[model samples]
Target: MRKDWCEARKNDPTPTQMYYAKNGVITPEMEYVAKVEMLKPEYIRQLVAEGKLIIPANINHINQIPMAIGRAVKCKINANIGSSALASDINEEIEKLKVCLKYGADTVMDLSTGGDLDEIRRAIIANSTVPIGTVPIYQIIHDIKDLDNLTPQIMLECIEKQAKQGVSYFTIHAGFLLKFMPLVAKRKMGIVSRGGSLMASWMMKHHKENPFYEAFDEICDICAKYDASLSLGDSLRPGCLHDASDEAQMSELAVLGELTKRAWEKNVQVMVEGPGHVPFNQIEFNMKEEQRLCHDAPFYILGPLPTDIGAGYDHITSAIGGTMAAFHGASMLCYVTPKEHLGLPNAKDVRDGIISHKIAAHAADVALGRVGAIERDHAMSDARYKFDWNKQFELALDPDKARELHDESLPQDVFKEAEFCSMCGPKFCAYKISQEIAKIECNDYPKEKK
Candidate 1:
């Protein structure tokens, strides 16, 4: 370690939090995360040191509010916000970020492959208080028309640009090795990841190993310099329910597991990304297997939709699988929007996706009884039982929507506190009817001997 890096370097250039934690140095990020997770600083530091948790705050991302993802803390949700070649703009992407964060998305990834990619990332990072993640290969291939030109050097350059620009983590698909290609040959949907597919194609054309895999150490050096976490993208993730947990996906996971250890050696924080879609029954198996194979490094999984027919309602399918995955120990969920497989999402879709995953993560937390998870649910139930409309709205997952629907039918100012609403007139209200039944029992008490 350099002397200047310790004192004169604006911040402690301790390589990464994992480095400090492993060395028993509780960093500022760790202390901040301990407060948010309601855990002792030592506990947070220990788990992070052991590669069981990740605080994906890059040293350069000054505005980021530190977050914890692992088995010990509350499960986190990530929303994808970016512009495709067809729709490319900055303002709308920022709007989407606002919507996801408002609905409680723990992190956001900019998968922009169009427009001013650098500018889009800078704007999102500047406005975002939460840690931002990105895929470097998206931009490397975005500019180079032919896949032949996409080399290891270009990829590293892209990673350097984003890492220095306050990006907290990267989704590098170095796990997409050449041998896994033939395994996905028989799948229903082959290679769904844009970066993953581009990489596979590039490797096939050059008859060479994946640049990301070959140059992974160089990549680690860059990540360590900026304290960026590695999200080890699942390039071979299943695209449909039938393809879930297949040989190709498993092989990629094994590679990711190996890469996780390599990243740790470089003091780079690491997490393994999981499936695109999986059957309901296999979600638990996948989550557990990833934890076992990755040495319990934080597992971040996409919705892994349990059904393939759910086009417009993919958010529902995603939540179904996400619930089981999180319950089984997956630490982070990548939200799937209602428009999945149909079109890019708008702001409302972003809200819907995040709310759906938030429900899944919270339900899992409650099931695990982690810390203070159950209290919020109990509070909501109490509010409903007492007919506290405002309290009910406040306790709801989507408070604005809850308030709007309640006021739609019972618009009067007096109805705000009334025990009855438009759902049922006062005569049919269940709580009121129960009260009347009790009154009847009191009034009709058997008479004493006359």
Candidate 2:
């Protein structure tokens, strides 16, 4: 096995501090990510110092590339593709990963819960050029013959194994302590997160403290050594609008707040993951509370799906919530597929989910005044006005799909003469009529009635 990069750098201050203490020094990772994001190094450094952003670059994971998550950059989108015990096809999962990447996902998480968890994780890490994140508790719980078999040592071993495999970040459900489990027992969804549910069940069954929470500092030490970012999981996130912003959720968030501080102190990069389902009215409050409570660590959120009724259209619901969440200061939007609350997402569902979240991320970037957001929109509008079909297709979030749909709607032969599209046809082409009127009015007008 390779030596841990973070352990080699452990004698030095943390990456954030390294940036803050600087005399204009920049790491290669910082420079590369800055160029990709079109932001200055100093600006990125400032956000890091303020604890409003994170890059999740594990030193051990040399193959793991860097991407910024913060207010100052383009909002980032994360696509989750993984297998479960009930359904584990490694090749299908890889195809889904490709689909996400092709559709413009900024990051990917392998939430696989079956089929040689270690092998699946290692395969993903090897194939992924972008940072890969995982929930270590899944493996821990999956390995147990009985729920009662779970212990702190088993959990830590799983985390260490993944860390060794070069997982850049981990969604440690350390916030789900025994003290907070009772609060969630009365929740509407009652622990919707798989990791959360597993831990909760283990704690309730054994009548013991959550090992992850009880040994958080130890977990931090291990993570810091590997330079893996700790994504403090929201074990009690509201699973439906009815449960949005309830006491149980807030109670777990309070624990996450304290844990966030601890992780930062250990120089472990940290982000807070949030809600499963939240109403439109409450999304802003949830974002604000997360920033306030988590000390402004980068906020990663799931759909927070505004309503629970859109079973087949949950992607739309998630995008709606995601746009609001991002605009309100959520740093990362985890794409939710139509299969949400239904079944495992297939490749098409993954693509649809990624494209929807991409739209939400870009929309939020435009709203937040990020560097290139509005310019792209204006460029697309120009393409539309000029009837530049190629340019318009190129500007789309999913260019292939856009072009395919355009072909289906209007074949090339039909519009060969005029710049008008099939949607308007020849008789009612608004642009054509507007142009004709402009020419006639300009040429036939009488001296402006002077």
Candidate 3:
């Protein structure tokens, strides 16, 4: 007779570092994360012990490159890529995933609401070297054509299936309670989150509590079994600047805080998701509020876009807010592509979004003075002053774009090392001119040779 894992592993230690850390033991995951973060394994264990940091490596995500997310680690960014009801297939979604990972997305979410959700998720998860996250309610809605008929058990089952398949984190919207539904009536853009709106709708139709909230304990058990982290979704997050930091958002945040403690109680790693759109002046406040309310369980924010008018250039807007959010205390940024507010992002949009957030996260790391964060910026400036174009390209966030743009006007091999780029065309290059001026100053001070 074969024993089930529960019985067979009864005496064996859990793979979750939190489980191990709480017991004052450091597992290999802790050791690997220590090397990746450049901190000692013992220190990593301590942070995990305090619940100040999270390492979202599911035991089944065997190929994952382990990473830590919290105040202690370098700021991280997540890229969202999945098929919508209209565009993209499994291949296209996977292609986008490749672009996201290539461009430095710390994690990826398969937000597919169309065509074979399982197939798409499985393909992405099977090939993903980074953690894959998803909103399981989407699949439940897909399976149950009638929203009114959907049951709590169905939602939990679908999510458990994914968790078992190696989803490192989940965006469960347990915070969107029925009472909060009334507050959204006054908002400019009501219920912008897909998962948030769906949960609200189910609540309204059934006249009941949010199922995810009702089943929070069970969700914790499932996530813990697989060592998956919880990214408690902010379903009431503001969709526009005017709706930001409003009562609805804060109320849900309070609930998320409660859930965070509960998830921690079971040793399930938790990170709280935050705002949709917010003004620039208020971005820091949002970060602080979430940190305080959620007890700093690694806040992950979606742009908190400073302005609403950037439909075509939301990636840039996201970068601006993302930099500030991370600098203020956010641990992870969900990349908002140029196609935001318009349509599903394509391959280029994914690449563009990842690159933008990479800039934001790195800028935040530099601002926070994370070790070795400023070295690359210093190196780039030095390369420019010395006309080391090759080194400059290497130091660029999107090196391909940097190389391509520079080569557009100066395609010659000799220009690869030249002090001037097409922007200045040798004659007007500021760095080149500075070098010439320095030579003149040296000649004028030749008496130093005597």
Question: lDDT-based ranking, best first?
Answer: 1, 3, 2
Model 3 score (lDDT) = 0.87
Q: List the residue pairs that clash in candidate 1.
A: none
TM-score, structure 3 vs. true: 0.94
Instruction: Kindly provide the TM-score of model 2 when superposed on the true structure, using C-alpha atoms.
Output: 0.92
Tens-digit lDDT track for model 1 on 78-195?
A: 9999998999989999999999778888999999988999999999998888889999888888878678887778888889999889899999989998877788788888999988
In each prediction, how many residue pairs overlap at the backbone (N, C-alpha, C within less than 3 A)? 0, 0, 0
Candidate with more favorable, higher lDDT: 1 or 3:
1
lDDT leader: 1
TM-score, every prediction: 0.94, 0.92, 0.94
Greater lDDT among 2 and 3 belongs to 3
Q: What tens-digit string does per-residue lDDT give for candidate 3 at 8-102?
A: 33454455658879999876777878887778899999989778899898777777877889988999999998887787489999899899888
Give the distance in Å from residue 65's predicted Cα in candidate 3 to where it truly belongs.
0.7
C-alpha-based local distance difference test score of model 2: 0.81
